[model samples]
Target: MDKGKNKWAVLVGCNYPNTKYTLHGCINDVQAMRDLLVKKFGFDPKNINLLTDKPGSFILPTGANIMKALNRIVDQAQSGDVLYFHYSGHGTLIDKPFLPFSKEEAIVPIDFNLITNVDFRHLVNKLPKGVTFTVLSDSCHSGGLIDKEKEQIGPSNNHLHGDSSISCSKPKAIPYESVLTHLSSLSNINTTDIGTHLLEVFGADASLRFRLPHVELEFYKALKQDEGILLSGCQADETSADVISEKGEAFGAFSNAVQQVFKENSGPLTNAEVVSIARKILANQQFEQHPCLYCSDENAAATFLPQSATAASSST
Candidate 1:
């Protein structure tokens, strides 16, 4: 099938407001991306869908908001449509018995909620084959949030534990202390609340003290790889930064770099090209950011993954 000259780009960037424990720059990034997609990527404004924190939390995605829109937008997906999904905010991973959650398993909001990886999988499953599923996550513990963290102690569990990495085989368990430590640092995140939940899932093990861990993203399943991509600002081994410049203005290092790359580069870039340039811009901040690129285009649609993620490989 031939591609649509007017591809769709869905961007979600949030900027937390009225509080310190919120993400304040993602909202700007989402809007900026929306503009770039329209002006540079040939995306029609109508095809672009943007979501943010509800009731003016101003910057965050609640589980309800994500679920509500999942079906509506997915149903509209057509062959050759490019579904661009970008999330900039908080993220986490679960360790132990972590099967990806069904839609009901997680709640998402400024109030602190759960969102399992299956929610995302379900969204992908609903799309017509050959549509581009691009996602960018800026949250610290985001990897596990996309995958289901299972409780290790099962069948009359005493403590709670779950892991969120999904692969062809059953997912391996991630450690509890690792995921929780990331949660504790969030401005409004309560260590007790995160710990309590982990305890419920894994069962309290006095022998097992909690340790902090970074989130990790599993590669896409081959069956689901009709043509999708994921670009992370950095690897799980590194810390994703909140940019506080000498001017005292704060933003996500990842998001800021994205804006810079587009602002500096001319014309539409390929997926590899975009990732390459974004990598450079991010490195300048000393954040050790790395732009990731994943493509599921059997027809080689990855070559057409918006010239954003595949920047270096293409010529503008």
Candidate 2:
């Protein structure tokens, strides 16, 4: 652990207000996580960058804005610093026709500009070797959020096809009504069978070939060697629950479970331990989705928030 290293966090939550996909808990989830980071993990409040869909918020979680924020995080990060990204929103899977039977998982921003697993892979690959990137995604189809990372704690991969790390059935989808609402809000977008058009135009192998022209083919070919820890809300085929808790507060089931688990445990927990306990908590609450952990085998046993948890536990 780097004693003088800084801690930076980018917390994003999209509720998609006024649309058919309006969620009640995304913003709240990020807020709760922000608080936890500051209070428990020793993250400096000023270093935390928050992007949310609440009206008049400083920044909105649009795809471009998100990319910019991520770039800033990576650019300013020093080796040994801890970078954390938390996103609570809708997730989807888009087919990559270039690769036969390949579907990329994506996080939906407020403006509907999709941020795919490829983008995340690019970001993670750019991180300094010693820096740790932790991503917590509380969204549907959130498994494999970091792209090509090994699943340290998840379902058996024997059922997964091809290079997919998570064992999942057919990917679930957002409601068509939500898709219509989003498309209709865009200027000059013809809403007539726009979904079909998206599949035909964006789904083709041609566009993907040009998507990242700056990067060499080898960049996409190689799996990332940097440390990236992903805690996903559910398997690729499952829908995450966004329900109100018994106390009348709304939150994503997996996010809430993680919070509760973290609050209860004071010892230094590994990634595998945290995921295991969080999964049990969600299951006890009757959530259908199962939380997953993805990282290298060594990191699976590393202390969660390595510096913070270790220091705290040693002090006790």
Candidate 3:
């Protein structure tokens, strides 16, 4: 868990599953991401791992398969090693409150069933201290993942759904801290950050019993300085994404935006650049999908590798 030491990563993207839950760009985009990490970021193939549901001559893994793969890496995760978690697929909210959950947990995965807020708390709590974690979620929502029901936009500026035209002016950037402030005002019990607050909106426990639940999370605080970052495609008030890109590939604008950034940047780029690039791509994107990024580290950055070069390296 030394920040000055070397780093490692685990990549997961699911697409073309035998089941209907499969998505369009999860697999392809992750593959692209892995490539960028390797050839560009200089990650050792032996050190970097890839997980997906697709079964071919690649490092792809399935849902259950990915769980097993997680078993192999989580224990070895030391501090300072960057752990980047990415998911590109359908995301919905489970309205059933019967599923028990705890405060320190949340289930943010691709295919989740019988997954409770407590379930999430258990998984993240195991991360090694100081091991930087970056989670990117590009799916339908309520955390609040799903909208529960479809929303019809009205033409009025005040209407937000469909024809309910929202503010005609360009959506301005709201400070991340401000959103956190708004989120904080909503809950009075165990005060927490944006991630914790969002999870609590529909947090597993409804009674709000214990002020602090004893979940075994590495506690983002323990590794707050290990370069941890989170880039959400949308805000707590908005849906993530669902769209196809210019390549005719069905993908969330976020995932496509990620892939596009990897393609253009030949060298190391700051997180700000990545966010800016993704935002620009979304603006011109065929659909209304607008990708976004969130960060805790002001100086964190990523380098990308081209597709052909990455594939060739993986093949060897």
TM-scores for the candidates = 0.64, 0.82, 0.56
| Worst window of 10 by summed lDDT in candidate 1 | 164-173
Candidate 3, TM-score vs. the true structure? 0.56
Please provide, for model 3 over 1-316, each residue's C-alpha lDDT reduced to its tens digit, 9 standing for 90 to 100.
2131344566766553564344556667677766766665556677667766666636544334444454455567775555555665544333232234522112233333112233323334566765555555565442321111111111111212222112221111223344345546665545544446655553542212122344422131233332334454654445555444344655556766777776775544555576666666655543343444433333334322212344445434
Alpha carbon RMSD to native, model 2: 6.8
Please identify model 1 stretches exceeding 4 Å from their true place: 18-20, 54-60, 98-108, 142-224, 297-316
Model 3 stretches astray by more than 4 angstroms: 1-4, 16-22, 55-68, 96-111, 114-129, 142-227, 240-247, 292-316
**Candidate with maximal lDDT:** 2
How far is 178's C-alpha from truth in model 3 (Å)?
34
Best by TM-score: 2
Write down the lDDT of every candidate, Cα atoms only. 0.50, 0.72, 0.46
Better of 1 and 3 by lDDT: 1
Error of 2 at 30 (Å): 0.8
Supply candidate 2's per-residue lDDT for 6: 86
**lDDT for position 64 in model 2:** 75
